[model samples]
Target: MTDNKQPASNVEDPAMPEDVTKESSQQHIAKDNAKTLKIRKVTNIILLVVCGLFVFHLIADRFIPITDLGRVRGFVVPITPQVSGEVIEISVIPNTLVQEGDVLAKINPIDYEIALQTAQQNVTQAGQNMGALSANVTASEAKVTSAKASLKNAQVQSKRIFAMADKGVMSQADADNARAELSSAEAGVASAQADLAKSKERLGSEGENNTNVKSALLALEQAKINLERTHIIAPTSGVAANFRLKEGVYAVAGQPIMTFISSEDVWIEASYRENSLGNMKAGDDVEFALDFAPGKVFKGKVAFIDYGIDWGQNEQSGKLAQASGQTGWLRQSQRFPVTITFDKEIAKGFKRVGGQADVIVYTDDSSIVNVFGKLWIRLISWLSYVR
Candidate 1:
C-alpha cells in the first residue's frame, strides 16, 4: 500500500515548462539592465559635481585677491642737523617720543653767538660809513656853494675891470688878472661838483640801501639762523630711534644723526603676484591681520599699487646679460607691492614697522565669491597664532 501511495504522489506532481524558465530568465536580465543604468546615472552626476568644483576654483583664484606677504610700513624720517657744530648737550633718549619743535640736542652756541656779534658789528660799521658818506656829500655841497659865490664875485670883477680898461680907467694887466681869477673860480666850482657827485654815488639812493649795509644785513640774518640752528629741534612729531648722539660729538651739517619713525601715522604694504591685481582697485575694502596680534582683524583700504619692481634688472644698458641656462619647467611669478592705509590707528605695541601680516581685498564682484574669500581670510587670521 505505501508503494502505491508514492506512485500516486509522483503522478500528481508535474514538471515545470521550458517557457516558464525562459520567462524567469528574461525578468532577471531586465532587472540587471535597470540597475546598470541607475549606476551610470549616479556616476555621471558625481563627475559633473567634481568638474563644477574645479571650474569654481579657477574662477575664484583669478578674481579673489589674497596675500600673506604683507609688511607694516610707516614714514621713517632721518633726523639731520642744518648746521655743523660740536654737541654741548644731549636732550632726548633713544626710542623716546618727541613732539615737533622739541629740542633734541644742543650745539656749542658760543661760536654762533660770536658770529652774530660779528655780523652786528659789521652792520653798525656799515651804518657809520653810510653816515660819513652823507656828511661828505653835505660838505661837498657846501664847497660847491662857496665856489659858486666866489665865481660870481670874480665874474663881476672881471666885467668891471674890462669895462674900466676899455674906458681907460684901468690897465689891461688888471683886466687880465680878473679874467684869470674868474677862470680859477670856475675850475674850483667844477672840482666841487665832481666831489659832490662822487659822494652822492657812494651814499646810494638811501642809507639802508648801501651795498655794504645790505651785505652786512644779509650776514646778520644768516648769523641769526645759525644761532637758532644750534638748538637741534624736531622737524616733526615722532618716536626717536637710534639716537646715538652724545655730548661733545661733532655733528656735520646735513648728516643724519638719528631716525625718527613717525608715530602719528602708519600703513601696510602687501606684496602680491602681478596677476592677482587685475580685479584690485584703489579704495577697495581690505582686511588684514598681524602675526603679532593673533586672532585680530584690522580694516584698511587700498591706497596705491606700486608701478615697479626691483627685479635685479635695469633699463637696457646696451650690454647683453649673461643668462643662466634653463634648469626647470617652472617659472616663478613676479610680485608687486600694494600700499594699504589703515582706517584707524591700532593699539600701541600691536603696531610694528615691518611686521608680518596677511591681507585680503574685497572687490565689488560676485557676492558669493566674496563670501568665500572672507571666510578664507577669517580662517587665515585665526590660524595666525600657530604660524
Candidate 2:
C-alpha cells in the first residue's frame, strides 16, 4: 500500500481507541479515591467520639466513687443489770423480738422486798421520833412559863421580906428563906428553858423537815428503786441477742448479760476513699445493697461523715501510732466512714447491724453522669445476687 496508500500503522483502530480508554480509566480511579477518603474521615470521627465518651466516664467514676465496702450499723445496747441479784426467770429467748419496757428477765426479789420493808419501818420510826420531839418541845415550853411565874412570885416575896426586916417588921431568917426560894425558882426556870431549847433543836424546822426523817425518806426511795430494778425491762424496741441467763444464775450489777440490737433505728456505715470526699456531703443521695437482700437496691441519704478513724489505733497500748509511711511502690488510699440513713423501710427481718453492704454516693452536680451512676449501682445490685 506504500506504493500508492499509507502504511498499515497509519490505519485507525476502533477496538482500542486511546482517548476513550484513557478517559474511562481516569474516571474509575477518581471515584475509588473519593470513596476511600470519605470512609477514612468517618472512621476518624467515630474514634474520636468513642475516646471522648470513655474519658468522660472515667472522670465521672473517679469523682463520684462507689464501693462495696460498707456495713449495716445501728445502736447495740448492752443489757446490763442495774442491781445485783439472782436471775429467777427469763421472759425472752436469744434473738427474740421485744418491746420497750418489756420484762426481759426477773431477779430474785426477796432481798429487795425485805429491804423495802425495812426502809418503810425506818421511815415510820423516824416520823414517830420527830412527833415525840415536837411534843416534848411543847411540854418544855409550858414548864418554862410556869417556872418563870413562880420565880417572879418568889422574888416579890423576897423583896417584901427584906423591906420588913429592915423596918423591924420581920425577922432576918424569914428574909433569908424568901431569898433562897427565889433563887431556887430562878434555877428551875433556867433548867426548864434549857430543856425547851434541847427539844426545839431535836425537832429541827418541823417534824417532817427533820434531818433524820429526810434521810429515812431518801433511803426509802432508794429501796423502792432497787425493788423496781429487779425486773429487768428492755430499754427499747429491738431484738434480744446473745442472751445466756439461766433460772438461778447470779446477775451482777453493771455487768452486761446480753446484747439488744435496737430496731428503733438503722443506718449504713460506708467506707469511701479519702480522695473521693472532696464533694461528698451530708444529704447527698446514696444507693446501697445489703448482703441479706441481694438484687435489691435501697435508697438512703448521707447522714454524717466520721471525723476520725482507728487507722493508727493500738488497742493494747491504748494509744494511736503515727500513720505508717508509704513503704511500697503503690500507695494505698485512706478510707473514711460515712453514715447513711435509710430513706425507706428496709425489708422486714433484714438483720441490719453488722451486715455487709455495697454503697454508692451521688453528688448534687452532673445529672447526666448521675443517671449513668444509678445504672451502675443497679447493675452492681443485680450482680450481688450472684457474687
Candidate 3:
C-alpha cells in the first residue's frame, strides 16, 4: 500500500552545513539584509514628507495673498501770475501755514501805478474835450436862433419895401437894396443852422473825442487790474513748502516759486492685489496706520476699486513679435489701487496733504472661510488625520 513513496515528515536536511566557518558567513549575510531594509524604509519616509510640505505651500499661496503699491506723494498749485514785475517783498518763508487770501509776496507795483495815472489823464482829457464840444454846441444853438429872428425881420421889411415901391412911395433902388438885405439875412440863418448841425455831429458820431473816451475807459480798466496784481494772495488754505525764492529774487512768469498742499482735500489711496479683491466692496472696513506719524490709526470705508491695470500691457500682447525683449510673465497676482478716505477724526490730528500710511482691508464675507479662519480649521483637520 505505501510502495516506492518517501515519508513526508521523516526526510533529513539535504543542504546541511558540514563546517562551522560556512555557517558563520551565512548568518552575517542575513544580518546585513535586515539593516538594508531599515535604511530604505527611513529614506522613503523622508522623501514622502518633503514632497507633502511642498504641495501644501503651493495650495496655501493661492488662498492667502499680499501686495504693496508703493507710496504716493504730490503737491497743489495755482499757476497764474498775479503781478508782472520784480519781487520786492517776500513775507512767507518756506513751510508756513497760509489762510485763504493771505498775502505771500508783493511785486514792484510802480509800473502799475504809473499806468493808472496815464489812464486817468487820458480819461480827463477825453472828458474835457467832450465839455468843450458841448459848450460849442450850445453857442451854435444861440447863434442859430438869433439868425432866424434876423431873417424874419428882413422878410417883413422886404415885403413892406415891395409894397411901397408899387405905390411910388419908395425908389426902385431902395426896394432892391431891401431885397438884397433880406437875401443876406436868409443865407446867414441857413449858415447858422448848418453850423449847429456840425457842432452836434462833432459831439456824437463824427467827433474825434468819442474815440478818445472809449480808449480812455479801456485803459482805466486795465490800470485797475494791474494795480490789483500788486498783492500776491493765497488762493487756498494750505501748508506752504519748497520756497527756493526770497525777497528781491526775480520769480519769472508762470514759474513755481513754492508749493502749497491743501489740507481740506486729503484722502488715502491704497492698492490691493487683483486676486485678493474678489470679495472687496465699496463699504468694507479699512484700517490704516501712518508711517509718518506712528501710533495713529485711521478708519475708513472702501471708496472704490480700479477697473483694470491702468497701464496696459506691452504692444506685444495681441500681435506677433518679431523678437520679444524680456517681457516676462505677468504676475498671476496683479494689484489695483483702492481709495479710502479718512473719517472726521483724521482731520483732528494729522489731516494734511501728502501724508503717507499703511492700510489693511477686511470684508464681512470672509468670516469663517477667509484666510485666517480657513488656516486654523485646516491645521486642526491635518493634525487629527495624521494622528
- Model 1 lDDT per residue over 310-380, tens place: 77755587888866454665767779999998864454556677799999887775557888877888888
Cα error of candidate 3 at position 339, Å: 4.0
lDDT of each: 0.86, 0.86, 0.70
Residue pairs with backbone atoms closer than 3 Å in model 2 (clashes): none
After superposing candidate 2, which stretches have Cα over 4 Å from the reference? 1-54, 310-324, 327-330, 344-348
The clash tally of candidate 2 reads 0
TM-score result, candidate 3:
0.60
Tell me the tens digit of each residue's lDDT in model 3 across 26-70: 898888988898899998998889898677544433443223342
Off by over 4 Å in 1: 1-57, 310-330, 344-351
lDDT of 2 by residue, 113-197 (tens): 9999999999999999988988999999999999999999998889899999999999989988998999999999999999999
Q: In model 2, how large is the Cα lDDT of residue 290?
A: 83
Candidate 2: deviation at residue 298, Å? 2.0
Candidate 2's error at 360, in angstroms? 1.4
Question: How accurate locally is residue 55 in candidate 2, as Cα lDDT from 0 to 100?
Answer: 93
Give the CA lDDT, 0 to 100, for residue 74 in model 2: 83
**Model 1 vs. true fold: TM:** 0.78
TM-score rank order: 2, 1, 3
